[model samples]
Target chain A: MTTVHTAASAVSAVSAASAAEEKVDTCASEAAHPPPVARGGYTISEVVSHTGLSAHTLRWYERIGLMPNVSRSHTGQRRYSEADLGWLSLVGKLRLTGMPVADMVRYAELVREGEHTFAERQHLLTRHRENVRQHIAELQDTLAVLDFKIEHYADARRASERV
Target chain B: MTTVHTAASAVSAVSAASAAEEKVDTCASEAAHPPPVARGGYTISEVVSHTGLSAHTLRWYERIGLMPNVSRSHTGQRRYSEADLGWLSLVGKLRLTGMPVADMVRYAELVREGEHTFAERQHLLTRHRENVRQHIAELQDTLAVLDFKIEHYADARRASERV
Candidate 1:
């Protein structure tokens, strides 16, 4: 009975290890070509493709202090890390909201200052969120006006046709 | 009896005329200093204040054909009409949505072309409204990300204080 119990426990352990390996494999496959393991570093061209930003714009972002200093590969080309990609993603979203480049640079500065500046970073984001909210409200109001104007045009067109 | 009926009718007529006059006064008062009657001709400075656009920008807009030609007074000073104010208001809203200046110029051209372009104008506005809606959606999503990040910072700070 002791031997049988030991054998069963060993089988269960083997099954569990196999399951964990399968999970990892699944995750790696799901991420495919850009798997986390392979994403330790990216070339400038790779980042340009991933972020859909022009090479010129990426260089400009770096020059304007929007991006932190990128590491260099053996040949001296820019090599962006996972954290850099994450930062670029956030910057892309911020740019969509029409936040000025200067403001983004400020945020980047706060980030570079590390854990001590977390409160300031949070405050900056809160203020920017408020600005975005106000902008969204304004856009909604403008949308209503546009809808009204469009409807007027449609009614006028129908009336003209009826005439 | 006829005299009494005539007196009643006269009273009603006077009340109706007074109501009409009151409506006119209400409208004028609601508009305040920049009443429509007074809006027939605004100087450059007046347009600048009304539109919150710099005089330089106003001139630039005019140069770019984004604005219709302004009339000149006896001394050749530019006089913007109520219609011009209305157009500027529309332009301001469009600008808020980040519509390209060239597109705005096209819209201005459509306006100058008159009634036949109503369909095209409506199409342009409809397209712009869609763009604005998409932009609002993107901003809302970004806001959510910011809120999440802010909450993370708050949590981190709380943890540090506890330590």
Candidate 2:
């Protein structure tokens, strides 16, 4: 549960300039011209609630260099911007693909490293995409097996009733 | 690694009658008329390679009553049948769906309980099928994110080169 007013007031207490809105996509497509609160940002607990990631995991992501540069409040609390949330949203999806955390960290490093790593990042993502496709196919194949077994069981039940 | 000759000879040494080849789908469709070795069955090592499950896991399946009727050799070595392999194959597929082992064990129980549990088993499988589909959907969504990021990087690279 998050208290929006309290979080916003905390964000207000931090005197930082608004992050420049550029079309430059760092990790994901951020909200265009975010509100002062959106740009000023969310607290760690707010981020935890919004992303369904624990505070520890958020901290760990920063520690492992899996996260981009996160701004801090005047009191030194981490203040996550809309762009950070956008990046986190991408990371959340990546986690679902079961990609190795190390690979994700590498991708983050590449992003932080700049456009020179574009080709390498694309290659890594393409390979993971292939893996996800294969994983889906495997699950689809099992659905057929489950269907076959279910149908057979239904037939067996009917035959038993007749006897 | 599975040795066809040594494993076959080892199987034939066991004095088990040919498994009846009725089209009765207990777990899965079996090879109608298996050769003497196929009927007599494969050694645990052979099954390990075939199913990609460890020997410890195979034995654990037996211990937990997750296995169907697995026959034994003269020296008490497990002889996995074609039907047994079929069942194990299905089990392997179920594991890929990320279904809990307890749930899988329950499905095994329903199968072992006979035709009376047909409806319940079907319901359980149908639910699992839904979960698998949703999981696939989630992965597919992530693919789009990966595509967006990759394309953005490619564009950024081109821009940087032009400058």
Residue-by-residue lDDT tens digits, candidate 1, B29-60: 54447653454477898766555567887789
Question: Can you tell me the DockQ of model 2?
Answer: 0.30
Which residue pairs in model 1 clash with each other? none
- Among the numbered candidates, top DockQ falls to 2
Q: Write the per-residue lDDT of candidate 1 for residues A1-163, one digit (tens) a residue.
A: 1111112222232222222221222223445567533544678777665666778878899999998788776687787765666677677677666667788999999988889998898898888888788778768867877899999999999999999
Task: Quantify all predictions' global Cα lDDT against the true fold.
Answer: 0.69, 0.68
Model 1 score (lDDT): 0.69
